[model samples]
Target chain A: MFLITNEPLSVTEVEAVVADPGAGALVTFTGVVRDNNLGKSVHYLEYEGHPPMAEKAMAQIGDEVTARWPGARVAMAHRLGRLDIGEASVIISVSTPHRADAFAACQYAIDRLKEIVPVWKKEVWEGGEYWIEGSTAAS
Target chain B: MITVQVQLFAAYREAVGARQVPFDVPQGATVLDVWQQLQATYPKLRTPRPVAAINDAYATLDTVVQPGDLIAYLPPVSGGRSLIPSPSGEG
Candidate 1:
């Protein structure tokens, strides 16, 4: 599944999609708005993405997953606009027959999204906000 | 003839002085044509930015544009949360 939403995402929502009988393992990752970064207190986070480009990139990622794991199920959602503190900005869930595939594929999806998707994350910090470009962050 | 709506985001929106630009190209005008026309019509676009995207993925002049297709013009993703309003590639 590929989605772009403004609604707050929940683990339950993700579990609903991943609770498949055939899959033995489910892996999910959520990127939240951290309260502090670079020694500043963050108020909120704004996730800006090139909708058209980002959507296309997401669909392509799904295709890549299918190619790698023939029968695996993949779902991804990204939140846009201003997100309050502790809110999930992005979530990815993957279900595969094996635990290793589930872990690897889930990591692949999130990493690829960070690397290629035209999404930008801005940290709304105390006094003023700044876009966080954590060098260690995956695409 | 087909009309494709292209939205400019961030720097592109500011440079063009507008949010969305409508390109009414001949029916079956490839995405490339729309891009070239933007440059041609707006001499200011003579210096094209990085790559362009059609319906999301990276596209070139060769990509086709449909009547209702929404194309996006994206600049490199930086930390700036460009509050440029609509017609930004994301809208």
Candidate 2:
């Protein structure tokens, strides 16, 4: 399951999608807004994206995990709009028959989400705000 | 003239002061041409070379613009990395 929402993210919501009786391990990762970045104290964060394309890209990541590990199930979601510091911005969960596969797939899911997803974040710091230029993905 | 919608994100959105805008370009104008027009209108938009998307799919600067096309200008992406091959040749 892949989703994009403006509401706060719920870890249980994502974990439920990866619930599998046959799976031996489930790994979940949540990316939270931090209080500092690049030596600057961040006050808050604003996230925005082309919701349709972002969700489509997220689903593609799920498909990739299944193709690589046939037994793995992936669930991921990203929150859009303003989020206070320490709030979860993204949540990813993966289930597989082995702990190693579950862990690996979960890592891969988050990395791919960062590279291909259309989401962008603006850091509102003490003095001013700036849009972060993280990856140079032209698409 | 062919009209197309330009969708901006992040800094590009702030530069143009709107999330989306409409532009009327000359016939046979390409995606790059539309971007040039935008730069002319909002010089601040020249900060980054954003990835272009034509109608929700990845596109190149050389891609031809069609009437009523929606061209999205995406700023640099953060954190997310694609394992698959992207149109821009990045991972």
Candidate 3:
């Protein structure tokens, strides 16, 4: 499933979907907004998604993941609009017959999304704000 | 002839004075190529645009660009721990 929401994400819901007895492994990744950056204190964060296109892009990514690992269960959810600190920004869960594939696919989802998803985020620091888009430097 | 459509988000949108921009890309233009040309014209547009997408996902230069293509130029996003109200929404 592909979705963009302004509401907070529920990890329990995500876990429930990927929970399958046939699956030997399950992985979940949550992206959250954090306070303080560089030298600035972030008051909040804003995310915007080109919904229609984002969904299409996500589907393509899903297709790629499946092709890479057969029988992999993949799901992704991304947050939109302004968010408070510590809120979930993105959630990805992957389940597979083996733990290895589940781990690999879960990571792949997060990595690919950073590169291709048409989502933009802006940071509002205490007293100031700036819009920055791109993947986390390390990821 | 392939017409390319470009959309600016956040600061780029405000900087360019609008949210959506469409242009006819000369046949066989890559997303990166369009980015270079647009940057050349909109001098204020800065570098290290943390991310980019064609049709809403991370796109590559090898991705063939055609007329009516849509590209998004995004400034590097600031990742903080919280969500706030959109400043633009403020009256």
Residues A57-104 of candidate 1 have per-residue lDDT tens digits of 677777777678776788888888899887888889988888999888
Looking at model 3, residue A89 earns an lDDT score of 90
| Candidate scoring better on TM-score of 2 and 3 | 2
lDDT of 3 at B37: 73
Chain A TM-scores for all candidates read 0.86, 0.95, 0.91
Q: Ranking under lDDT, best-scoring first?
A: 2, 3, 1
In the range B19-40, model 2's lDDT, one tens digit per residue, is: 9899999989988889999999
**Candidate 3 CAPRI-style tier:** incorrect
**Candidate with better lDDT, 1 vs 2:** 2
On residues B17-74, what C-alpha lDDT tens digit does candidate 1 reach at each position?
7768777888878766776778777666654544566665566657778788887776
Second chain TM-score for model 1: 0.68
**Residue A50 C-alpha lDDT in model 1:** 73
- In the range A1-139, model 2's lDDT, one tens digit per residue, is 7898999999998999989999999999999999888778889999998888898888888888898889999999899999998899999999999999999888888877887888889889988998877653221
Residue A98 displacement in candidate 3 (angstroms): 2.2
TM-score, second chain, candidate 2: 0.84
Give stretches of model 3 more than 4 Å off. A134-139, B1-6, B21-43, B46-91
lDDT of 3 at A130: 68
Runs in model 1 deviating more than 4 A are A130-139, B1-6, B10-18, B21-48, B55-57, B61-71, B78-91
Candidate 3: deviation at residue A54, Å?
1.9
lDDT of each: 0.70, 0.85, 0.72
